[model samples]
Target: MQSSVEAIFAPQPAPEGYAEHIGTGLTLRRSASRANAQQVHQLRPHVVEMAAQYDRLTMPVEIIHGDADTIVPMHIHAEELIKDIPNGALTRLPGMGHMPQHTAPQAVVDAIDRAAARAGLR
Candidate 1:
């Protein structure tokens, strides 16, 4: 969907499929949704509790992760998640670290856009 709210000044224009969250910080990322750090704070408590539900999700999931992610090992997190999620897929960034969105913004956008299209969002 096109952004109903037009963007003005930003650290950089949020790339396609991404939105800039300028509230707590001018952070930008396309997480398959418009959730920013502030919004995440509210859901933090429930995230761990919801992990078990990933396997039960029927929605298509696209995981764009880094092969070198030490913080959350790709094999452990992304690989395992893709296996669990019924309609899930994964794209790995060869040399990237933990933050694929920051290290490979365009790639992240492309992956998210594909996922959104599959989910009928774009």
Candidate 2:
């Protein structure tokens, strides 16, 4: 029996398979999907309500912001999120654009290690 699916609609191969287990470096250009602003607009209310509920107002958190980020605008979201978080420390990385995981993998790893240590995740 012939399937109804067309050849063009077949699933594409995953470039990096689970067996590879590549290092935690990011590939945002290939990974990130640019969504329409309108799509995000519809979810704003739900997002804000969720944020208010899980603000982490009493937890010790470290926030690192890329000053040159255009996707997640430092002046808008990250800064405000940091402000709302109690005992939050913000690290502003100058000349670092969006997607620090790709541009500064070491820094991201270091931050995670530090956070883990602080949280006693040894």
RMSD of each: 10.1, 11.3
- Point out where model 2 deviates above 4 Å: 1-38, 54-59
| Model 2 residue pairs with clashes | none
Among these predicted structures, which one has the highest TM-score?
Answer: 2
lDDT of 1 by residue, 85-105 (tens): 888889988866665665578
What are the Cα lDDT values of the candidates? Answer: 0.67, 0.60
Candidate 2, residues 1-122: lDDT per residue as tens digits? 01111111112222333223443233224443244445666788887886886456655577777787655678897788876776667778777766566556787877777777767884
